[model samples]
Target: MKENQHLVHHDATTKTRHGQPSTSPTSIVFNAQPFGGGPGATLTAVMPYLRSRLKSLGPIALHYVGSSLTMDFQKLTETKWDGIHNVDLYTNPEIGKRKLVSLLQHLKPQLVVTAMDELVAAAAQAAGIPVVIIDLLLWFWPSISPNWRQAELVIAAEFYGVQERIISENLNNVATVPPLGPPARTTQDPSADVLLNFGGMINPLMPKQEYIAYSHLIYSAARRAIELRNAALPESQHAKLIVLVASFDVAQGIDPKDPEAARMVLPDEALKLMASSELTFCTAGLGNLYAAGAVANAVLLLPPLHEGHAIQTHLIQKAGVPVDAIEWHELTGRAPIDYYRDSLQVMDNVSKAQSEVIDSPQAQTALVGRMLAAMLRSASAGVSAEDPPLRTLIKEFGQDNGDAMAVQIMDVLEKVR
Candidate 1:
């Protein structure tokens, strides 16, 4: 694990503090999806487990590859990471890949661990670095990329259609892991009645104005729904809603002191808060759904915020899961299921699939109605089952396999070491 001083300074927001590069004997690079916080959160959650397993190697260098779109890199600041490389893959893929490859070549790491960032993993493999790709969205990949086929290992989160896709792809190197998210709470007391968490509320390809509108629509609807629900209860029994966002862009211009306004926090802190909440209302992201479901007592999914979100929301509903979802049709009046599939064709563009809803005058009104309905249903239904729908989601999708993934990475590192 030798470092090149010049490469260390190449657009690195976080770097080792040594006056001279150390000559550590082993190194690893952890790269995560630049767009969403979920992939990065999974990678970070696995690090502690991986780190403990690799401690015998004695001071191995850890490098993180991330982007500005997410707060993933911030979570690694307190960890034993030596360098953080922030690249702009969305604005310029070729240049980002070049920078990434150059960094990998300089570090010459023993292994590369990536979560949903196929391009980064591919860059590493092209540079002769062993790669581990974490497919958090394994449930919905219609086709496999050649880049994935070449990876040293693929750790996939198990879901309904996951095994079928893996079998179809003939991916011998793949390992089916459980749903990944924030670890469960041990002794935390319930803090909020309902938590409104919208994970990584930005898509690079989506227009900023459109995202602003979308975020506000969801936030306002959720807040109003909770308010209406609370109005029906005794003053002491009123349910509280706390809006959590990774960026202020999701809910801007509100007093930070306002309990109902959005408050920006790190991924881990947000999950910790989720564990203490009675109910979690979030977007239909695989990572978000799993993390919230695994920890919170009750979980209800909000509508699709992106194309990938649209697919996952539809799949969850199709699977006949008992969890409630504010579907795309309710908000957009676009029930043509094929529309979601067609959106997948242009999925690479990564824009909002429900443009009709975003542009509609009644979008916010519809969301309010749906959210209030869901809240009222939950309040009236009370606790019905021993194992809730959230648990059902966890049973259907695999359990948290962060530790298993860490062990696998450690095994690879041990072989190389």
Candidate 2:
């Protein structure tokens, strides 16, 4: 049967002596953009795992496409690439498309891997290269929608157990990979206190009343946690309550240079202040989650998103992190004051739940290894490698601590099944 050619574009020169255009048996190019927020941090944290995965592919040239605004990609570019192109595709899809088309024509990658960016995928498919779409979050945007039927494969984090069902129903090829925990950070004492952090661009459609209400809810929740801790513990032993608000530099309906508009938005100094706190209270977004995970335990207060909020929430909770559900109404009203008064009870419940499921570091490393293995296996299958030895590659990358991490990942996978 002819493959579904709609999703990928192919060159007229169909046959090559080697797997790819060059002498190399197989070549894959990864097109990843910088994640703007918590998801970005999650992606950044998983870089080690990704690097390990790339190593498993054996001297394959990996090209990461990203914006110039973030410097994180600088270290990645030091490695030799068949080619490297940096452009703000997310901000300017038209220019991105033109540049990406040029890259595909020049690189002729056998496989292209990306998070769901439809324009890039469509272009790759138009070039006849197989595309793999990783849906990092549960939500789907109409603008950059995935055409699963056209994609060679689709991979999603295991936190979205339902995704397998969704994909099976909608797409021909699909796989579910477990959440590889955030990349390791410098060790520090996990803060004993509760921390809160929230982020996202304020919705322009959201009325001024709505923003005020949301801020009020957060304030009330923080105040309540404080009251509960103080009342439950002796004044000396009470845990500190810290609130960090990581606001987007962009504001709704505001001019960039307007001081008054800037004042209306949350300040950078405020975010720094919040980061310094022991605990963070914030809505569920990638930036806030990573910041919390990077520094301390968090009390994740998820805000509603049109899509993917539930999946994101599940991943956060599954990581053995503490989280609480505060209704939009509660946040908008002063009722959170009373809620915080009862926070000691709520926090205790969350803490207990977190302790039971938090995977050990060894387990996390193994999970990371497994995810890389799966991606490599998929890539190998597409390129028709003869039983490639990925295990050895993983060990070479220093992930062979033991089968403990793999065992833990399998256990989680089974539970999801």
Candidate 3:
């Protein structure tokens, strides 16, 4: 809270207003992990808002450390941090820590923000620096990393983390963050076709080979869906079947023969595509799924082979994602194409059957798909169970919270100052 007796100025490259220059009164360090695309994307989505808020309050220095060995940090170069470092956590943990600490001490930031990374969180707290930990995984409360437990503050997102976050919210220095991301597309052409998106699976929970196979299955299914749609209607009536791949998903094979069939886009681009999709079949990572429900008329999920896939899927579904949103067939091996082909019909039949059982006296919440229902229910319902929470969240946080995570961190920075 005391003023820094030691004068330190890291000239930020981000031009405040055209030719005008600004000096940061405080520094904030961000340790970002882009491995699964969730953390990195979340950070980027919120960074602009965070910067805007920080600038209004006063000049504040920004610094970033990309915890990836092979990822091109060039993607984030636009962030214009006073300083940026890319370190390999898996290969050289000690060196990475040392480099990170040195940068932290030099900047002497007012606070540090980490995306579910324990080591970086721990290091910052160890230095007596205030830390705001972002809990994207919604990890078990008791099982939460000790590093996160020590934060000056922790913000668990509303949807992907709402369940465990209830417990996290009560924990020392923790609170529930409104669903965080850029504005989603609301205008929908209900008649739009499907978007076969698997997210940027650059970091696969499953083996690379297996990931490719599963991705191929989805791609092939998407292609077939296009054909079926073309045949089912006149050529002029055919709908768009766009497949947005990850920047790193080069092996998914975008089918050069049909160059328009697929293409790789940045994380933000993928999110917009998913939100604007009419029907979406995407990998069930928290990052991808959270953005999928925005405006899509129908959304079915496929889980990447991950150890925590079951729990991650369970929590979201419990929040009222419906019995059909999660496509379990892909993981169980019935062929993903079948799930995509009759998905609409399948969802209608399944929802009615599930609802019937749900209304039965003998039914239990543990019914195989009890919590699940096909997302095919028309958007006419206006507000699904999940929608209210997000709707309330947006109202509570405003159209945006300047990147909910950063906004919260800035509060801490201001308080101590």
Candidate 4:
């Protein structure tokens, strides 16, 4: 029988890849934009709430299609993912779309969940399957409205200036929700001075050497900044820095003498450390931005690693978030306003914009100085407000939307089941 035929009696005939009788009454295919850590963080936040609701339905088959880098997050350590498809393997867009559709037909999942991936959302829609999209960067997606409208539900993680932007009224499927992030910690750990994070530090647009180069720059700058800060303080009041590593390649290059420099932490563990630390030094990825904003007392942004990071940093700064950042244009002799405008034009090709910045040795050296300066400024300012900028961004973004999206997922599944 042809694979598409399974759709007619999907639940009844659905079997594991091994061809054994299937135990799951419902099946779901999940895909997230494989570029950075944000998608994986979004998925991690929603799963527990989603699985709690699925208990009554017995076992549910889960398959994921995205970059292998996402798996390195170690968030879903306990999840029994039935199949894994590395979307990065299909470098050709047309071929990837066809393969995705074929996978959907063969799996015959009742529903599909995608985060910031237009390809997966569209492919599942073409296969006549229901789709739920978790839109982390709502402010930047106006250009791709038609493509994403194909989804049955689009959950937008809220930010400060979302109301100021014009959204398409024709796209009524959109659901506004709080910034999705790991749960907040009740107790703060004050021992750690800074949590240095570069996010999942891998993207399609840049080569491995560039990533490693940028990573080393950030790592070195953060270390030097901590050394300067600790120099003035008493020996007993010295600060500690911890780096979050998401890739083995990135981890291997970190200083081995400092064990904390390359700790591969799970999502929740990262969040806990972020809360405990006095400051978070990282890139401007929406996932980590919202998370650090939601839980950390203070945040200092490194330069943009890609177009998305640059755009997000611009938006947050414009909204008056008060977070300090090392702007890319400052180092490259370009105007910030001009860079933001150009980034919008080549937003889809994130790596293209990144290549321009990464290829410059002067920019890399200047970035280190900027990173140290921002850290010193943050250290001197100290978080005094009852609501710091990071906390305020989270408060404005609203409460956790994980449970709410899980409810929406259950409703969609009920209709399909």
Candidate 5:
């Protein structure tokens, strides 16, 4: 994890680790940020990895955001720890005040892990919880991004950017966080399946019928492709595609090895899978983006509904997001049901929810099928001999060898006195 020379600006009165050392094994409560109204992969993926590494210090509590915590996050919280609590954060600060405050008091955390969620930070500070904010994968968010970019102190992924503007703007507070992703990759099987993941954007969408129809469409197209390929080549020589839709346990014909695997995938296992990938088709999320980059040499980034993703990808490309290695396309629509529903029959809700784009399931299926076809074609041919070395990624995210991030966290935490 490299850093810009001007990243950390120390005051005469404060030093990261020079001050009266805080007690060893200081407890912490990680904020389960629910920003942008979505389920948290950070909790399921990033935090667990951090927690395992950080446990040597002291007990850690996980504070989820929302009235109710379910899904993968809840399952993660079920793991034994110092504490496991849910609170209404960001979206409902006032609503969560009492609950959050009580939990902080109970856990007595020296640090409240925050991901540029100022609302949560402010609340924690108010409750006497020292806050350490970090940027998982986004920068230049219209409201939150710019502020974190300017914070007197914060951690960010170096690949996202040098934050050169911030350096020139303030000569101060910053730290470099290595690309947070899966574990290191082992040997990649040449026959490994191509990995396809769209994260939460694909699951628990609406109108079961529409989703099923779309699934059928994708399966038919893939089967057709397979049939044609087998017609020309032996069955053993056909391209293998491993599609992971977290929401759909059973795919029409695109069945994943395990639907629940996304929530429970081990870092080491995840890295190996990605490494074996011939190509990856996934959404632009902080966790998955970096994970995909860690292993896959080739990638196809699908746009999520949020404009924030656009901002993140565009800005990071300046530093070293491997934009040169990535092939960006906008041929398909958004990956949600609200939008996926557009490709379905003309229902009143669909008309009311929609305006211009005919975002029906059929259109999405058609586009996704074509996208899959493109990916499969690439997989069938095999990785290029001259494709730019994945060195850019090696620089951007560092090696996926182990939980080295834990050591980095220790470096920062010991100084949080």
Candidate 6:
């Protein structure tokens, strides 16, 4: 293993460093989804595992690529990463691909890893770099066709088991791995009555109205559940119900028509609410789910994708964690009140389920370590195992002999940059 050294600048806001850039051992991980919502949360969950795994090898570097919508790249750069590369792919895919390919060529990384996004992985492979694709998003949606079958290794969080199965069934070269849980808890328990968290930006992908309705349903169910529980308890034993909303957008407040909506709480205030909560209600996003689970709180997951509930619900069940899924119809009042009652019953099971699965930090650390190891192995072999055709083509046209090719590549790269 190489000694850890700072290869880039260090500022209070961002610490960018690398061990050394060489094909023998160095790896470059490009995380293309940097919007700080669902994809961002997923990255945060996996980062600790990735860092630990990479540290075992030598020095590792991470570069984030994508448009900065709601997230702050500086937040990620503060970690053990060499640098940040902002690639605007949403505006123009072709130009984005050209620039990304050029960047990979310039970096000459031994391994390249990315989450499940076709364009990014395609670009990396086109540059004659090996690739590892993480299918975290598959847990939320059924498998879709991806063009990059030549990836050296493919991994997915074992949510519903569908992602791994899909990889093996569709892409012979892929491997399935369990997702690392969210970052470990740092503070002592505050213990709230209920915790509510939401993610996915306010866009067509995850509509604002859907979030509003989702929030309303959880708040209504939680309040009702507490009332039912309190009614069964002695007056002295009854406690006030608490609701903590994490990563909610205040700018797009819940609709006034929904009288059942919970009051908005700031991200800073969530700790206090969580400390007070005996139960939690949130979406199935990786960050919020892990945080609640880590703290031993029972969760209610309302994922954004229509088909997501099946896999997410399955994972929660497999973990022996207390979780329940609410359909959109139930959230929007289209479903009967019995649906909400059933969800509340699920939350009622938190304490017993919490004890069954909530172990020490060792389990979490071990899981992360395994994931990182798999990711590193996939990345290191990215170039050689995946892109023989591209490499052969490039070799045929020697760098010094192809002025026209050089001009075309440069033109494409310049436009994207």
The best candidate by lDDT is 1
Candidates' lDDT values, in order?
Answer: 0.69, 0.42, 0.55, 0.68, 0.47, 0.45
Query: What's the lDDT for residue 197 in model 4?
Result: 79
Clashes of each: 2, 27, 6, 1, 11, 17
Tens-place lDDT per residue, model 5, 1-417, is 332122121101111222223443455665545432123444444555676676565544344333222233344333333334445553455756766666567556666766556666776777755566666543443334444543335666555444654465453566665665554343334553555554443322234444333344344444454455445665666655555543332233233543432333433454565677666655566555656555665666653334344445555576544542221132234332232233223233332323212345555445555555555565565546543334355455574322443455556666774
Higher-scoring candidate on lDDT, 1 or 4: 1
Once superposed on the true structure, which residue ranges of model 5 sit more than 4 Å away at CA? 1-26, 35-71, 74-80, 90-92, 143-152, 182-188, 200-233, 239-241, 245-264, 312-369, 386-391, 397-417
Q: What are the models' TM-scores? A: 0.85, 0.49, 0.69, 0.82, 0.65, 0.55
Q: Of the pair 4 and 6, which is ahead by TM-score? A: 4
Q: Write the per-residue lDDT of candidate 3 for residues 271-319, one digit (tens) a residue.
A: 5666655556666665565565444446666543442444556665575
Tens digits of per-residue lDDT, candidate 2, 1-417, equal 333231223211122222333444344555553443332223334433444544434545445554431223333223333334464566567877787787677666767766555566788888888777666553333232555557766665433234645654564455555443323232233333444444442332233344344444334434554554456555554555444432323222223343233221132333444434434455655444433443322233444331233335554457444455433222232222212223344333332322221223442233223323322232222222221121121122222121322233223323322
Lowest summed lDDT window (length 10), candidate 3? 366-375
lDDT of 4 by residue, 1-417 (tens): 234233333222222345424454467888777677778766766877887888887778667677656766533355445556655433678866766676777778999998877777777777788888888776675465665667778877777545444354455777777777655433333553778977777775556666776777678767776787777666765677788867766777666555446767777678878887777888788778877876776678877766677677777778777778776567777645334455434443433434555677776567656655655655665445455576656656666748987887788788888
Backbone clashes, candidate 1? 2
Worst 10 residues of 6 by lDDT: 388-397
Ranking by TM-score: 1, 4, 3, 5, 6, 2
Error of 2 at 266 (Å): 23
Candidate 1: which stretches are off by over 4 Å?
1-8, 17-21, 71-77, 182-192, 248-260, 266-268, 275-278, 337-361, 383-385
Task: Give the candidate number with the greatest TM-score.
Answer: 1
Root-mean-square deviation per candidate: 3.8, 17.3, 10.4, 5.4, 10.6, 17.5
Off by over 4 Å in 3: 1-25, 69-80, 139-142, 160-170, 182-191, 204-210, 249-262, 266-272, 307-309, 323-403
Ranking according to lDDT, highest score first: 1, 4, 3, 5, 6, 2
